[model samples]
Target: MSSRQRGNFNYKLAFKLFSSFFFLSAIMDVLAEANGIFALNLLKTLGKDNSKNVFFSPMSMSCALAMVYMGAKGNTAAQMAQVLSFNKSGGGGDIHQGFQSLLTEVNKTGTQYLLRMANRLFGEKSCDFLSSFRDSCQKFYQAEMEELDFISAVEKSRKHINTWVAEKTEGKIAELLSPGSVDPLTRLVLVNAVYFKGNWNEQFDKENTEERLFKVSKNEEKPVQMMFKQSTFKKTYIGEIFTQILVLPYVGKELNMIIMLPDETTDLRTVEKELTYEKFVEWTRLDMMDEEEVEVSLPRFKLEESYDMESVLCSLGMTDAFELGKADFSGMSQTDLSLSKVVHKSFVEVNEEGTEAAAATAAIMMMRCARFFPRFCADHPFLFFIQHSKTNGILFCGRFSSP
Candidate 1:
């Protein structure tokens, strides 16, 4: 070829590569924001009563639903897509590919931390799933297709799946499929498990920890094991909203915990109501935070939470997928099978060493901070989430009100 032609070819190749990178990066942002929104919405549902502590892994739940969406057809697909923000993408193919890339990205562990995520599909041995569906799951989600005798051995099948989940999560989660959660009528199940353990880049001294008062409400207070540390960190304080954010990085810069606390006089509900995908992005950006040396006091606590997600998803406009006759998952199987229930369980422990957490969610389906040397004391109710910095993937999110 001519020299000019070769030069033009090189330029075109470089441009295509650049464009692909740009596109993927944009999609990652969209997925991150969507995950954040889902997290907040789920919390809203679980906390509507506002009398209990709430916790779960939004990423795990989203991954499980995304797999379910793979088989969804017609209106069933439409509703799931809309609720999941997958409709913002070009199409189902792109969304699945984005999730595929994401699952791979976030699961890659750095030298300083362990982050593991796995997806699986469990179906009755008698059921026949489409080869295309199984292939897509294996390709996009790296999900294994396992056959169980849910028909003749309901209890055994439930125990087997629960054991698999526990093993995947290092035994941090167990009995995900409660007794009576599975029955002879159960035909298919989709599940995802995520486990993460990361150490603080700068560890808090054990000697500084002490029992401190944690204000649960206007009139209630409880003593908590509050961990104290003073260091230079990245932090953001919003005067208008009366919220403070702190970013605490793990040993590697790949992951970090972001904490959001309302002002002393402000209730957490005020900040929660204003949390949106746009606002989450705006708050986490580097430009929003200032570097300073400040004192930090955080509670050392462990929590476990479980939920029957069937009603929750239905209320979120995912009704068709859970309804027997209305459900259309033709792409997944040729049989007359629809989601009966979805269950989620998660456990989290945060201490001076860092954080260890695991979460499991079944589509029985139908399916931080901050830097500051500025005295950021988390002695009251506050919201916190662990995220992958590169992909902005929210691993786990929760609120600590009392202890």
Candidate 2:
């Protein structure tokens, strides 16, 4: 009640707020690094064939796995923490809190764009999962643990989960889990869905879009509807990889599509081989890009892709989580549980107006879990990413190698 006491109290409150902000910022940086590393790793894994196109939301996949990581214990938790880059972000509660903060920021209301992310846990009605685990998921990830009758109604449970994912993603993603993906052995399933729609700050004139030749490779070519625009945009060049970097801002500027186009003489594989988390950070730094009026030509394309993430995560060193004997998820329940499957599906459409993208990821424990732009010109194959400017988090990323 005293003046000095009041002053001290105010100072303490301010300091606490500052500390919290700093902590959250550090966590975001760690997450961004993790996302970048994982994105490149996934690209390399899925892009073994240079002739195919690869697309998915790294954020969606990470969010789904982080929920499973919440229940993981011992080696299962350790491997997941390492693979998901939670270990570098201080691990344990910090990782969850980081995601909580991130989800809050990305899903903020009143933004000019539409970006929503939702998480949920569908557990077998008969299983006795720990109350602490359920509470923590709800508290830190805004994910509710829902009880489902996976034992007797396998097909119904699958449809229910798919329906939820479809609803969350505005119907952009449906049937995330196919008919047999879940069965009587399934006990728990963790799901995460993200949807985003935004308009370009400087929309390309629709009339300017024309059918153009897209060089798929030295010996292959396809016709694509190439959108064209000349505007002032952030552009950079990476001589090390013979790549051109361009930033295409969406309306409100909170999100942007970044494109990396390698010179025709250099194969995209070369650029992929040289990409690392550190290099990605350096290459995409705002300071490294300059704003200038340039002609941009990007193809209007739509991609709907699906992946079985069990093998992908396993190859990335997340083995114990899938191994029933070795897996440890004591924090979730006393039940001897192991991940059975991880299914992910994503849809994205890029056009003269802007972009709409949605992705859903499900970890069926049984359970387990689981662009720009620059278009100086994109007549050749290139890599692109839709990134959150504030947190530097990659929302969706892929290689547009084919039409």
Candidate 3:
């Protein structure tokens, strides 16, 4: 081959490889952002009373549903793909591959922090899942297929799955399936669990921790153990009148907590309304913040929340998956089976040292920014997210309203 031709060939090869990587990365981002929107919408639905605290893992729920989507056919697949933000750019196959790539990237060991994500498929012994579907799930989602006697021993099967979840999440999450959550009619269950433990890149001073008043509402105030720290971190100003954002990294830069504190006078509802997946991306961009000295006062709080997500997901346009006759999961099994229920539970604790979190989701059948000089005192109702910085995957998101 001529030298000019060889050079052109090399250039084309490099471009193709780069584009491939970029394409997969982009799809991961889309899935992550779509999960964010789903989280917000669900939170809105769950918090219609607007007084209760909200917390859960969007990533855990998404991972479990994505596994189900792999077996979904026709409109069932399309609705899920849309709700989960699975783009059709590379079609279905590439979408699953992208999830695999992103999962591998996030779960790769060797960091100062610990993050473990796992999935499992628990099916009744009588049901025969497609070989191709089983292989794809194991290959892409790292989920192992297990047979449980859900038909004869529903409670035993539920306990077994919940125990597995607790083990995977380091016991932070327990009792993912409540009594009667899994019944004799249940044939298949999919579960995903994620656990994270990390020390702060800059730890808050234990000596500086003290009781501070937290404004839960216009009329209610309660004392909370507020942790304090002073460090140079990324900061930005965002949303309504005077909302501020701060990014706090854990020991490993791979994962970080993004906090959005609205002004004392402004209600958190304002912040919630303005939060969208696209806006979240825009606010978290590295370019949005310049390193500056920030005095942070955050409450040391633990939140645990559980939700039966059947109706929540249906409201989000994923109706067909849960319907017995309407659902199409032919790709999974020749015998007709549809999703029965979805349950999710999450736990998060933040203290002077850092943060530890865990979440679990089981499907029985169906599926920020501030200014430079500003001090961030999370003493009022505020929004926060613990996210994987690389893939922009939100592990846990919440609004802290009360002590």
Candidate 4:
């Protein structure tokens, strides 16, 4: 080919690649937004009881349900999409591809932290699932549909699934499927597990740790081991809500913890009620935060929480997917399947060194941080989030109210 012809071909190739890159980035952004919206919604639902600690992995739950959504049709698919904030114009394919890219990006190797997200489908051995559905799951979500004899060995099947979840979460989450969670009617189960262990970019000195009183409410207080450190970190204050926002980076800086602490006089409910996807994005924008030397005092705490999400999802306008006759997962199979249950369990521990969090979410379908030189002390009820800086995805989020 002549030099001019070769130049034209190369230019076209570059343009095509650029367009593909832009498309992928846009999809990721959409996925992130969807996650944020779902996360906040779930928080609102789970936070109704302000007396206890609430912690869970929205990422794990979203991915697991997305796998089910891959095969959902009609109203089932539409409800799932709306609840998940995945009503993008690109349709289901776009959502799946976006997750495909996200899973790959999050699980990429050679990072300073150990972060892994995995998915799998467990179906009754006798059920006949469409090959297209299986192929799409594997192709888009890297999830394989495994066959189990749910009819003959109900307990065995449950144990097998729990074992898989435990293995995926490095044993942090065992017994994800408790006794009787799977029975003869249980035809399918979809599971997603996320595990993360990372050290802080600036570790807190153990010697500086001291017992501090954490205010649960105006009338209640409890003693906690507060970890302290003085370092440079991104910090900001939302005067409108009387909240302080701080970012605490993990070792790699790719992952960070964001803490939102309402003023001592301000009720956490005030901030929670005002939280929205747009406001969260604006509050945490890089430009909105400033890096400065801060004295951080965060309590050393651990939380393990579980939820049966059928009612929760239903409350969020996802009733059709969980309904018996109304559910339509035709894209998966013609077996008239409906989601039977969605169970999620999460564990997290934060110390002077860093943080370790593991969560597993199973969809049993039956036919179904920083700092604050200004002294950012999380001595009261506050919210926290572990986010993937690169994708702006919320990996885990919770509220530490009692402890």
Candidate number of the best lDDT: 4
List ranges where model 3 is wrong by over 4 Å. 1-16, 87-91, 239-241, 354-373
lDDT by residue (tens digit), candidate 4, 1-403: 9999999999999999999999999999999999999999999999998887989889878988999998998888889999998896445588889888998888888998876665788988787899999998889887888989999999988998889889888898888888988899987776666666777877776777999999999999999999987666899999999999999888768999999999999999999999998999999987768987677899998888888888889999999887778999888888877776688888887887743330011011101132224788999999999999999999998999997
Angstrom error of the Cα, residue 53, model 3: value is 1.7
Residue 306, candidate 1: C-alpha displacement in angstroms: 1.5
lDDT of 3 at 189: 74
Ranking by lDDT: 4, 2, 1, 3
Cα lDDT, all candidates = 0.81, 0.83, 0.79, 0.85
lDDT of 2 by residue, 1-403 (tens): 9999999999999999999999989888888888778888888988889889998888878987898998998889989988888888767688888888888888788887777575677888887889998898888777888988988999999999998999888898887888898899887776666666778877776888999999998998999999987666898899999999998888789998999999999999999999987988899888878987677899999988888888899999999988878988898888887877777777777877643330011112112321222348899999999999999999988899998
Off by over 4 Å in 2: 354-375
| Each prediction's TM-score versus the true structure | 0.91, 0.92, 0.89, 0.93
C-alpha lDDT (0 to 100) for residue 19 of candidate 3: 95
- List clash counts for every candidate, in order: 16, 7, 11, 13
Q: Write the per-residue lDDT of candidate 1 for residues 1-403, one digit (tens) a residue.
A: 9999999999999999999989888887778777778887888888776657888889988888888889989999998887787777744587777788898887664467876665687888897888998899889888877889988899899999989999988888777888998888887776766666778877766777999899899889999999887666899898767999999888767888999989889989888888887888788886668988767899998888888888888888989987778999998888877887677788777877743320011112011433323689998899888988888888888888767
lDDT of 4: 0.85
- Please say which candidate is ahead in lDDT: 1 or 2: 2
The candidate that wins on TM-score is: 4
Show where candidate 4 strays beyond 4 Å.
354-373
- Which one wins by lDDT: 3 or 4? 4
**Candidate 1 positional error at 262, Å:** 1.1
